[model samples]
Target: MAMVTFVDETTSGERRDALGLDIAEERLALRELIRRRVLEEAPDGDDTDRAYDRAVEAFGRNGFLVLVGDRQIEELDELVDLGPRTEVVFLRLVPLVGG
Candidate 1:
C-alpha cells in the first residue's frame, strides 16, 4: 500500500517523511487516489506548502492504504467492492483555465 501527500512545486524537497503511510499488507494504486482539499485556516505565507504538509499528515496516517478508482457523482454515496485486498481512493479535480 502507498500513502500519498500533496506538495506545492516550490516545496517538493521537504515533502517526504512529512506524510507517513503504512503499506505492509496492501498494494497501492495511484490512478484512483481521490480526496478534497479544504483549507480551514489559511496560512499567511506559502499557504500551499502548509496545506500540503497538513493534508499529507492527516490522510497518510492510521495504516490506511490508498486505492485509486473511478467515481462519479451518482455512485458516490454507495459502497463499492473492489475486492477484499484493495482500498478505494477517489480524487476530484478542479477545473483550471488560462494556463
Candidate 2:
C-alpha cells in the first residue's frame, strides 16, 4: 500500500491515509477515490446518507479541483497512477460576482 496525502480546499482540511486506500495498482479511478474519501470522512449518524450524496454531487459538479502531484485531473472517470508520496489536493473553486 502506498501512502497518499489528501488536502481539501473546501474545508481547509488535511488528512493522511484518509480511507486507507490501496493505491498500489497501476491506475485508480477518480470516482472510487472520491467515494472512499466521502465514506471515510462521513460522520456516523442518521444523516450520513444525505451527507454522502451531497459530497458526491459536489464532486460531479466540479465543486473542487483535484490535483495529483501537480497534475490536475479533469474527469471523475479519469484513471490515475499515484506515486509513493503522491499528494492530492482538492481545491474548492469559489465563484465570482457577476460583472
Candidate 3:
C-alpha cells in the first residue's frame, strides 16, 4: 500500500493540509479516487452519498482540479498511477474580480 497525502489549495494561493489516505493499489481510476476522498470526508454516514454526488457535480462543473504529483487529472474515468509517497493536491480555481 502507498501513503498518499492530500492538500486543498486555491488559485489565490491559499493552501491547507487534508486527510491522507492509504491506497492498496498503485493505480486507480479518477472516479474511484474521488469516491475515496468523499468517503474520507464523510465516512459511513447518510451524508456520504450526498457528499459524493455533490463532488461529482462539482467535478463536472470544474469546481476543482485534481493534481497528482506534477500531472493534472482531467477525466473521471482516467486511470492514475500513484507512488509510495505521492502528494495529491485538489486545486480550487477562483474567478477573477470584475473580469
Candidate 4:
C-alpha cells in the first residue's frame, strides 16, 4: 500500500494545493500516475480523455514537470515507487523562452 500526496506547484517553486491518493500498488508507471491524477482532478462529467491528452502534451512540451520526491521524472513511462508516504509534485511550467 502507498499514500501518494499529489501537489500542484508553480515553476517558481510555490505550491498551490495538494491531495492524497491511496493505492495498493507499490509501483506505478508515470503515465498511469498522470492518468489517475487527471481523473482525480477533473470535475464531474469532465472529459477525462481530453484532459489526459492535454496533460501528456504539456509534459512533452515542457509545459509542466512531474517530480517524485527529490528526483524529476523525465519519461512518461518511467516507473515510480509509491512508498508509504510519497510526495508527487506537478510543477506547472512558466515559459522562459519562446512565448
Best by lDDT: 4
Per-residue alpha-carbon lDDT of candidate 2 for residues 1-99, written as tens digits (9 for 90 to 100): 565667766544543334345466657887767766666677775465677677668877878788897688888789878767666777887666682
Model 2 regions lying over 4 Å from their true place: 10-26, 46-49
Query: CA shift at 54, candidate 2, in angstroms?
Result: 2.3
Candidate 2 TM-score over all chains jointly: 0.72
Model 4 vs truth, CA RMSD: 1.4
Q: Work out the TM-score per prediction.
A: 0.24, 0.72, 0.90, 0.92
lDDT of 2: 0.70
Task: At residue 88, give the lDDT of candidate 2.
Answer: 73
List ranges where model 1 is wrong by over 4 Å.
1-46, 63-65, 70-99
Summed over model 3, clashes come to: 0
**What's the lDDT of the predicted structure labeled candidate 4?**
0.90
Against the reference, the lDDT scores of all candidates come to 0.34, 0.70, 0.88, 0.90
Q: Please rank every candidate by lDDT, starting with the best.
A: 4, 3, 2, 1
Q: How far in Å is the alpha carbon of 42 misplaced in model 2?
A: 0.9
Which residue pairs of candidate 2 clash? none
Best by TM-score: 4
Listed per model in order, the count of residue pairs whose N, CA or C atoms clash below 3 Å is 5, 0, 0, 0
**Local distance difference test, candidate 1:** 0.34
Question: Candidate 4: TM-score?
Answer: 0.92
lDDT of 2 at 75: 86
